[model samples]
Target: MGKAASALDYRELARRRLPHFLFEYVDGGSYGEVTLRRNIADLEAVALRQRVLNNVSEIDLSTELFGQRIRLPVGLGPIGLAGLTARRGEVQAARAAEAAGVPFCLSTVSACPLAEVAAGVTKPFWFQLYMIRDRVFMRDLMQTARGLDCSALIFTVDMPVPGSRYRDQRSGLAGAPGVLGDMRRVWQALKRPSWAWDVGIHGRPHQLGNAVPVLGNDSGLNDYFAWMSSNFDPTVTWKDLDFIRSEWNGPLIIKGILDPEDAHDAARLGADGIIVSNHGGRQLDGVQSTAVALGPIAEAVGDQLTVMADGGVRSGLDVVRLLALGAKTVLLGRAWAYALGSDGQRGVAHLLQLIEAEMRVAMALTGTTRIADLDRSKLVSAEAGANNRAAALA
Candidate 1:
């Protein structure tokens, strides 16, 4: 409602605008959320070197991703059930991303179907896939993406099974609920009158669009969740990628990679890119943060594949921090979702502009002219800080 200067501001607004269950679904992480907290903490711990007297009149934020030049090095990562956040939220987000000159990735469980989103936006958006048990469904989805002229296929490999997000259970969004729990959820939704009108009443066909062919159009939210939990194939392995590659000839990116071995394997598997992520601390609680895991994975396979990351990217400074650490580009999951939940497409567009402006200021202050020029040199090492402290003591 008020001026949202940062992503946190939008987050607060989103929390107020959305129902408790939906807000918690976007905000909460799995189990203890140790990795979730660590994601932001480690990014804050990264110190950028400051420079002065360097000409920073013009700062270029443009970069090429999968051969297309984008306005910024940021992409809106996939978020499932985004349509529930607002009226056709995924379509709004895609339109905003298109207007911002960046890519918007649509989730497999998105509220808006891929074909619908494709029709909504002028340019093609990226598609994120979850490897379910049915190979037929997966192949059909790939063909659909190709038919929609999707730019990239981001294969998410982290969620073998859904993680235990206590907040979801508490908010009555995840697990099967009793009569009282359903009543409480209904009450919560009733409290948000504007949301109730926009998403609950007008936003019809609450069914998962993409899953309709496999799960049936008559399926409800509970059925969709049950299907997702039952279908995420635990037997998925590197060899499974061969099947995906055989079906689609577009740029393939393996998401949810934290280890160097996995990055190596992704490159060997002919993946065009690898996203260093821990599913935004949703799938795995105690795993390493993307910021902490990005450097090693990037160093290992960056030359062979595009190294990107996502987690705790709340600001443009965080984006620059990721780039300095070796991420060619960064993805924003909750940040954009928060904006979408708060103010629909306008919030997302403003957030993108805010991040881009912050990145330019950060680049100017850090004496970096081009995004490609960013490296470890722009960051102050811990060892260097320790040595400086010791020298000062002496």
Candidate 2:
């Protein structure tokens, strides 16, 4: 059999297809991207034992989450402005996620309106909130989500103030580029004629789906983002979470948690689950990688709340590392975005299938027949001071 395709192959294709600003916004991380590098390094350091002569016939990948049977344990985490990646980006992503038997989360800053996206897809997708300062506006957004019959609301408590993503500032992502920069960006757009012809010219306008009357019939795209940033809530706290609980009754998930203490706080606030994330290393630069922090948070509050994790998850092997450490499910940020930017709906579907296929092989090599059988025992702690931590130490 020929060699399985590498993620870099897909990434390279995506890079070539996307405009410079959009690609950098999705790919770049905060500060020096130290946390980003650490996220991958820590996961790669984990060693799984490959057993020999094991009967590996049937593989069961199905798992239940929030009363839904997911084909795989991975789900698409909400990313802002995903629609910019492709035409009707949120709708395409949701449809692809649903087709793959997984839940697609719509962001507060998505391109399509909530009703429009809900109308476009048949499946009940999750909605993410970027809580703003205006209480009335927030209420209307929640009401809209409820009216649409959304399955869950993932309250992203991470970005009260947007991260200092230097890359984005450098790339002029926030608004219209300067004269020379605008010309360069347009030139970059021409390089990907398909994206320009399909999305840029013929597709529906990209507008935030969840923003209600504020963005209602906004005159231009610049006004939309200006309104979003100006009104985003900066004083959000644990008590604000309580207020959210009072408003929305569907399964409530608190995303943007990195510390175990915060995880405990979220569970105590009646959170059904907590996504242990550093916002994909987008928010904090010096923070501990989410992969490294997943174990402690899981051990701390795994019983109280469903523990999920995300950050630097580039391959199926990374998923195995996260699960072995104690994550019930994992979220992919750039993985799906890359697919959307490069090949539209089919690309995202193919990417999910590829990850599922890789999970099967990883499980087989480790002599596990089911995803539930994956445990810490299957993993030997990385060689510690030249000692066999898995065999020699306890």
Candidate 3:
């Protein structure tokens, strides 16, 4: 609505614009949200080694990923029900990403189906897949992605069982079952007249698009939730990855790798890349933040696999920090979602613009000219710096 200078500003706008439940769903994390807070805190604590008098007239933020050269080393990661943020929200976000020359990944539980999104954008977007219980459905989904000419297949492996998000329960998105819950959500929607008019009424048929075949044409959010509850197979193991690798011919990236062991396993299993993420702190409550987990994982498998990281990446500064921590590229989750919720395509485009601008300034100040040159050397360890200062004072 207003000029959003930062991702947090966009988040505030989204909080004001969208219904309470929808905003909470996009913003809140699982359990006590301990990991969620750490994701941001750890990133913010990273101190950059700023250098002066270095020729930074030519700063390049461009990088190549899976054979595609992007303007920035950042991508719009998959967020389920993203379309609810705006009318044909996924389509808008995809268009924005294409314009920005970055990847926009579509979630399997997206509000719009693959065909719909494909029809909207000229370039093929990435697709994120969740391991559903039905083999037939999973195989067909892979085939569908192939048919749509998807650039990459992101196999999200961390969500064998959905995490317990208390925010969803409090916001009437979960916990309250049946008509009572539905009515509560409806009442919240009615209060946000702008959102109600834009996304609620005009954005007709608020159902999970990709899941329609299995969920039936009449299925809505509640049915989608029930389907997820019953369908997410908790018994899934790394061996199941063989099935996915067999089906997907494109660049296959394993998302949600927080451990070096898992990164090694992904590389051994023939993955093209691995995203060092914790599902935006949505899956586990007390695990290490992506910023904290990325360095070791990158050292473990950076040569064997393309190392990407995501979680608490709110600005271009954070992007630079992750790159210095060993992320070849970084993914933006809540950042883009908040912008999308605030003003749809324009908000996303503006946010990307802001990120690029911030990255340039950060790189220039740090005396880094190229994205490839950004590594641990460009950062001053906050802990070590503090200890050094304490010793000097003592």
Candidate that would win on lDDT: 3
Measure candidate 3: CA RMSD.
1.0
lDDT of each: 0.92, 0.82, 0.94
Order of models, best TM-score first: 3, 1, 2
Model 3 residue runs over 4 Å out of place are none
Higher-lDDT candidate of 1 and 3:
3
> Which of the predicted structures, 2 or 3, would earn the higher TM-score when compared with the native?
3
Candidate 3 Cα deviation (angstroms), residue 157: 0.6
Off by over 4 Å in 2: 1-4, 175-184, 219-221, 383-394
Model 2 Cα lDDT, one tens digit per residue, 70-117: 999999989887888888888898899989998888888887778878
| Deviation of model 1 at 322, angstroms | 0.1
Query: What local lDDT does model 3 show for residue 252?
Result: 94
Worst 10 residues of 2 by lDDT: 1-10
Model 3 error, position 283 (Å): 0.9
For model 1, residues 1-394, the per-residue Cα lDDT tens digits are 7768999899999999999989999999999999999999999999999999999999999999999999999999999898788898899999999999999999999999999999999999999999999999999999999999999999999998988889988888867545666677778889999988988888878878899998787766677678877999999999999899999999999999999999999999899998999988898889999888988888888899999999999999999999999999999999999999999999999999999999999999999999999999999998998898799999
Better of 1 and 3 by TM-score: 3
lDDT of 2 at 293: 88
Model 1's lDDT to the true fold? Answer: 0.92
